[model samples]
Target: MAGSRVLFFEHTLSIKGFDKALEALDWMKEEMCKEKGFSRHDGGDYYDHLVATAQDLLDVGIKDEDIIIACLLHDSVEDVEGITVKMVAGRFGENVAHMVDLVTKKPGVDYKVGDNLKRYLEAISKHPGASLIKTADRIHNFGTLKNATPEKKLRQALETEKYFIPFFKTCRGAHPRYAKYFFRAKTTIEPHLWEIKEHYEEIEQLRDQLRKQERTA
Candidate 1:
């Protein structure tokens, strides 16, 4: 099978009610296919990553169906417009939907992305399932930062190292079953993070040198 198709298949198998989640996944895939940009595509692909991470959770001994479903659908409501937790609940049942809702940021809140991210982290602190999905989402996102501009990449790496690293550490304390996957994901992305850090340091040193040259001139 093609890699994407294989991914989709694996994702479908991970859901508790395979047929129902497949129905929702098909709807999500269709909705996302009509959109433009890599981010949208990347966001849609989150379903696959979520499934893989769900398997990781199972490997670590997490046995809750709701938590697993929550991982699969966590980003669906947030990233796909017109999709809501109420709709998911109506279709999939309440517990799965509630977990998704807890992780979904409100639409059009007008805060800077950073502030919105902070709000998301705060919400996750109170919900272990939400935190698990958040960690999975971050891992997928961080793994893709090479597609962005150097400056943007640097900023993202710094944010991950500074904010998300510690956040995942706290998540470990609560959801130890998820910690290994979280740490593995973090480790996979650390090289990029360090690359960005080193690049930023180089730029700052150059800027300082330019200032000193101007003063000497």
Candidate 2:
């Protein structure tokens, strides 16, 4: 039901000062569309994913309008060509831009290798607003990961267990105003990760069984 309730550009623009947020959304949509083949794992429009991320924040009772705006454009700097923090600041004010910058992965940093990921998570954790939006973003990502490849699904599940679970735990203490929401997100995400992990284990077992049968035959 939440999927069907996405806050469209028209609806969001009417929300008082959020009219400016439509500019960011427009820019994001244009850039994402221009980058042909850009899409969710399920082949849905990528802009839909951004809208869903913002809606997740709202559904969880987040009242910080800037955070919502940040969510709407969070991936722009990272995934969109020529988008920059300064560009975001000029349009949406500094706080929203700062939150977006905080979540964007730094250039040349391989998140799956070495300390890059740790430092990235640390930066986000230091800013509660960024962490809030990042959490919502991941919640959407994990929820829709069923359409992802098995390798990607396993990798995400493992990463969530290794990094996100602990991060969400700390958020309860560090972001008191949002603790309950973080907890709810954690509870929802963990079970799904468990299911993925279990599914993979079953697959591995079946592979082993087939190998043993082949040798015996």
Candidate 3:
């Protein structure tokens, strides 16, 4: 698994020049360790999610090394620990950094969560590379939703249906090679979302019943 991980990293780094990309990759490894959401054994870091998506692209015959690398590094600058797009660009070159920048959300924008999600979906629709990474991010997030609170799980499901599904559909139309994987991922996830939605409703009803019983008592 480690070898496969290294090969994927090398494959991505090869597009921008081996040594420079290696340095950036090393920095990224350190950053991944520091990041809050990264999983040590499961490869559940945002970068790992991107890698999984890139693997799907590879399986579908999309062999653009830059795109693959871009997919891998897509969330590194934006969501990883203490890394910046400028640093990625300076180390790995502009194209890679630009791809990362496209997907990175600005910190503390003060918008409502709904508005921020909308803006993010719009940004992904406008850029294929960003869309690719975002799709992978959603997939990983949905996969992990079982660990989240009932309220959070419901919100995530609604967000995926409302924002990500359409964006993934748009991305599929724009990038035909990835269409199959995107659809397959969507198909697998929809059922899970339905289950989560039902679970949330049941929890809410239980809470309501408890409140009513308390009032009567």
Pairs of residues at least 3 apart in sequence or in different chains that clash in candidate 3: none
Per residue, candidate 3 scores C-alpha lDDT tens digits across 34-117 of 265566344554445555666665565665555666666766765666678887777667877777787777787743477887
TM-score of each: 0.75, 0.91, 0.76
> Which run of 10 residues does model 3 get worst, by summed lDDT?
40-49
What's model 2's overall lDDT?
0.82
Candidate of highest TM-score: 2
Query: Model 2 shows how many backbone clashes?
Result: 0
Candidate 3 Cα errors over 4 Å, as ranges: 1-24, 34-53, 80-82, 110-112
Residue-level lDDT tens digits of model 1 in 139-183: 766776666677678777878887788777777777676678667
The TM-score of predicted model 3 comes to 0.76
True-structure lDDT of candidate 3: 0.69
Ranking by TM-score: 2, 3, 1
* Candidate 2 residue 179 C-alpha distance from true site, Å: 0.4
In model 2, which regions exceed 4 Å deviation?
1-9, 34-36
- What TM-score should be assigned to candidate 1? 0.75
